[model samples]
Target: MPPVERRDPEPIEAYLFDLDGVLRVWDGADLAAVEARAGLPPGRLGEIAHDLDRYGPALLGEVTDNDWRASVVGALVADGLKPDVAVDVVLDWSANLGRVDPEVTEVVAGIRAAGGQVALVVNSTDRLELDLVVLGLDLAVDTVVSSARTGIALPDAAMYEIAAGILAVPAPRCAYVGPHAELVAGAERIGMTGHLFDGVSGLRAIVETLSAR
Candidate 1:
């Protein structure tokens, strides 16, 4: 993809960041280790955990995090692993929340330093708060809007709307960074400037633009 340019027509007062791909960086080796211990093929556990039909309710706040994990474990058990072994494997896999990206951290700090607020907007489960605390990101932003907490997820406009409202900023004055094109488009539909987060450099470019304003 080409580099993202600084193209916001209006001054942005706040930034809405996506949690998983934008701020948190996953380590494949950790996953590989967990899969090895479980005698499962690489990516199998993740595939099961992210299966939309099984995970949709969790993200929508209809189920607890424990319920989601239990469902994944049950699926593994049905695939021939002993129930106890499956539970252990799921626990280990779920514990790895991944590390924060320092570059993105710098960008977030820069935005705040420039008088802009930042909110973490995510499609997540009830475990989000715990995971944020574990990753030392609970205080990293001005506010957080989780689908599990709001009972709404992107590309629904309400998620972005709630984040902007929390920051006391108008939707048109907020900028969004996310990996999914659909989510980015959703934010744009609500009048927020949207930057598709293809990489750190693209995000940095957007930050630079916002800072220079």
Candidate 2:
């Protein structure tokens, strides 16, 4: 909701992105689509995923990856599906992931062309590399900082510090973009310019203007 700091007189020397909302989206497996794939009625997967108490730890890496899958499988099997079938559905859903936003891809590439540094700063599981490969937008940014591998998550100062360190840019010199206000707030807390995603139209214009500078 705040003004885009990319418009500030101080030139933004680098850019960083969040995973789920900004660049790589998990739209490939929304509740409706997963229901069709798992042959379960709508709202089943939704109920489980939104169950913060059960699956939240897995998502935040508090639980092991296997434990997370087991939790999902147990829920599916309890609903009368066979173990093998549940496993297949869960695996399929997990593996497919999401597609890259082309606008973000273009903006990142444009930043690179203009000699700006770009990085992917995300809090996710160890599948970060594979996720990037699937989205095929790893080519857009110069580096990535994934919490699954880094053992850090957003709203944590360490996560932002690690990303800025990897990019070899000071936090104040980097512009952080994400969908969540809280997550962007984390970056801002570290003195990075934080921008909430409004859509590609606004983001592209900012990207272009910054690169032009």
Candidate 3:
């Protein structure tokens, strides 16, 4: 049998990560508990909070975080939740400090050890910066670009460009790790190598391959 030809990996100078599903995750059980206490169906809060129409302004920074939460409360009230109860539920939900994947930090360290820069590019609300601090992730990455801060959301080419610009690397020299196929496609469209992250093990493999180069 003929020897199979091996293709060399492209040069990757930086890594861009998606924030929510890639690195940080909220507790589903806690959310369910909140819903149960509020007499709302499971996952109802997430559906209401993340509905594109209601969330767009918040993600774009056109509305304050407080305003967005108030809108959620209003939605709950309209859904037959007592106004006070809705307020309390949202307040408790807001207090949720999502757990960060420790393995992601290890992967980040590996990337940095290999002379690669890292940045978090997220489509998130205005409170993202503050949340990072509270979550003890402010220093985890070299930089962070939130859609709310820039008024540009992912899977947009411009957002990836911004992160690449910050890292002082060309988009083609960057690797983007995101949980969604749409986001990965967006990164690839802008010439970046994209990895759809399923787990830390998959991410670690990428880091190992890049580090070996």
lDDT of each: 0.92, 0.77, 0.91
Error of 1 at 177 (Å): 0.4
lDDT of 3 by residue, 1-213 (tens): 999999776688999999888889877999999999999999999999988899999999999888999999999999999999999999999999788888888888778876789999999999999999998889888999999999989998999999999889998889999999999999999888899999999998877776666
Residue 110, candidate 3: how far off, in angstroms?
2.1
Arrange candidates by lDDT, highest first: which order?
1, 3, 2
lDDT of candidate model 1 versus the reference: 0.92
Minimum summed lDDT over a 10-residue window in model 1 is located at 204-213
Which stretches in model 1 have alpha-carbon errors above 4 Å? 1-8
Better of 1 and 2 by lDDT: 1
Winning candidate number (TM-score): 3
Q: TM-score of model 2 relative to the true fold?
A: 0.83
- Expressed as tens digits, the lDDT of each residue in 1-213 for candidate 2 is 998766555577889888787776666347467679768887777677547786556646677666777788888898788999888878876766766777777777878887888888877666667767766866768888876666667879898888788878888788888999998899999888788997888888777665555
Q: Name the better of 1 and 3 by TM-score.
A: 3
Candidate 1: residue 128 Cα off by (Å)? 0.6
